[model samples]
Target: MKQLTIVGAGWAGLAAAVAATQAGWHVQLFEASNIAGGRARSLQQSFAGKPLDNGQHVLIGAYSNTLALMRTVGLKPDELLKRIPLDLRFADGQGLSLPNWPLPLNMLAGLSRAQGWNLKDKASLMQAAWGWHRARFECDLTWTVEQLCNASRLSPRVMTQLIEPLCLSALNTPLNHASAKVFLRVLHDALLGGLGSSDLLVPRVDLGELLPNVCVEWLRTRGADIHLGTRVSATQVSALQHAASADSAVLLACPPWEAARLAADIAPKWALSCAELTHKAIATVYLHCKDVGFNGLARPMMALHSHAQAPAQFVFDKGALSEQHGLLAAVVSACTTERDDVTELVHEQACKQLGLVNVEVVQTVVEKRATLACIPMLDRPEPFVAQGLWACGDFICGPYPSTLEGAVRSGQQVVTQISQVTHR
Candidate 1:
């Protein structure tokens, strides 16, 4: 049997390992960290007194690739997460909830039912959507949120209540800098894709328990070698090209930067492409507020205004995950300010926003480089970085942003490429 070595046991690496092993290849997987989930892992902290995720992550019903991988690992969709309709509660005491209606119609109904929007606002939103749907598809490809919101007749209320939040959450960048094409792709998938596609799937357990841990067991059962806390410093293609090589292929299923560093000696040109990939930082702050009552707090996730009293972009209640303590997790995406002060400011704001003045300080875990910033118009590298060196991650060809679904899908793509190349 052919042997395949996968570096970086993140979602991408794990997915690649599972795919390769199932294809009858002898697989060996390595990770730099002791944990498996990478950014999506979960941990138990003393202060929180329960398991907590590295950050608050949600999977939409639109995330077909992610759901498929879960099924591959013997996890049911409903068992690992709770799926709910598209609903969001804004900070200004106004909220909008979308029913399971068809694509743009659901958005229209949700906007119509929004608490504080005026008729003119509604009309402007429809006009914008109509124009967007009718505009030259090529022209739509180059649009940005700022341009769309400004050039269109959307009212400030509609923009704030709908467009702004969706843009920030989906693009992970502020509206001004976020690419219009990427934003539309998200809307196309969530809104245009239909009602069932918009359902939000919130993880019920720690992220590690959800996929990576299960993946490890599955791979082991399939007779694959799994190594934790082992980093592959250098991957030489010449070694694979050796006359008496034992391994059939090497899959560098890691972040772009790491892949660039390892492939410099193996594939210089592909490494150059990897080096061009850009990344952004995301920080999550967790607070333990046992006595605080969050009866009115929005769903597990909601978009936040940067200028709002809180520095949080989204918040998740951990009460359902842990019965011993009420854990609140806050996400700060594409953060450019001082990480330390930002955490403190976010904590203070969250306490005030959630009415948790008496909440105790829990552990704060910061993911400095959580994901590669998916900038608009940026060229992405192909799945086959080199003849034997394969690349798979959220930053690959799946989509611009490095979301969970994108990462898993990219992995599946790389596996297909690898299978085809090896068979040849």
Candidate 2:
């Protein structure tokens, strides 16, 4: 029987284990953290009598691979997540909000009915969109998102309320620094992929319950070994490598830093490549109002007016989405501020913008290295590090940016590579 040992039980690692196990490979999964979701895990800390997540994440209907993985573990995506139309409205409803209609119609309807946008602003956006569609969403390698916006002649209003927020949320990098190629790819997949590809999928459950916990259970039933709260040392991995048969392989599904540390001796070039990649931080500030039934926003999620002081770009109403009544989470992507400042500023922003003055900060979760700083023409490491060593993560060489779907695709790609090698 073929044997595969995977390090790190994050989304990437968990997806690899599931794929390998289904492919009839004996799998062993290890995670350094007690929980399996890594950066997206649920925290033990309570806010408004509800569990908090490390970060607030939103998946799209275009995340086909991730949705398929959820079903593979016997979980329904529709049940675990609340599907809503693409709504990028602010507290005052001054942005684009797509109807639940089909592709082109929904986009057109939303664009036409966009609040606070003049005819010129809407026309400018339409022109830019048509240009991108004509070019097949392909852009120059050296171009940043800001450059793309300039070339497309997008208006300042569209840039501030729409493009900037989308770019920041998707890439977790600033507009001037984010890769235009990656940003265009994301736009293509969401806008042109399918009928409901652009729909927002908000998790009704915590991050762990959404996928990782159930995946672990599914793997356990299939005889796959899972080790949580334990790190796989280089010496132990080397010992396993010596004792294993020819059909056995080692897959590093850990974060880039840990993967670099493990593969440093075996593949110094790959390690150096991993080490050179920079990362960005994401901060989620949880807030709760005194009155549980008094909803502040018009929708479950509202886009914020971000500036120097107000760092949060988007805020999600946990009360409406997950039954965490009175709970709200403001998300600050590519956040560079300190924790204390972020919490205070977000609280003030919510009060000033959303009209929730009685809300108090429940918890502030800051992931220092939330995602790879997806810059223009960044060189990412390949999966095949050595003869029998492999690595998989969102940071792996892929078309997508550092996202859950990217991580899942990378994980599945490693399994496919392994299968191809074994068949040969």
User: How many clashing pairs does model 1 include?
Assistant: 2
Error of 2 at 119 (Å): 1.2
- The alpha-carbon lDDT assigned to residue 94 of candidate 2 equals 97
Clashes of each: 2, 0
lDDT measured at residue 120 in model 1 versus the true structure, 0 to 100 = 89
- Model 2 TM-score, 2 decimals: 0.98
lDDT of each: 0.74, 0.91
Worst 10-residue lDDT window for candidate 1 reads: 238-247
Tens-digit per-residue lDDT, 1-424, candidate 2:
8999999998999999999999999998999899898777888987556568999999998999999999999999999999988999998989999987876788789998899999889999989998999999998999999999999999999999999999999999999999999999999999987878999999989998999999999999999989999988977766665555559889999889998888887788998999988999999998888855686557889999999799999999898888888889899999999999989999999899987657878889999999999999899999998877889999999999999999999999999998898778
> Top model by TM-score, which number?
2
lDDT of each residue in 1-424, candidate 1, tens digit only: 9888888888888888888888888998888888898778877553334477777788787887788898998988787797778777655556567888787778777887877777888788888887777763224555667777888878887777677767666767777777777777666677565568988788877788789999999999989998898877773444653421333778777878888888888778888888987666777787766564544345665555455445576677666543434677777777665766877888787776655676655666767677766556767777776566677888776554778877887777788777877666
Cα lDDT for residue 85, candidate 2: 89
Candidate whose lDDT is highest: 2
TM-scores across all candidates? 0.91, 0.98
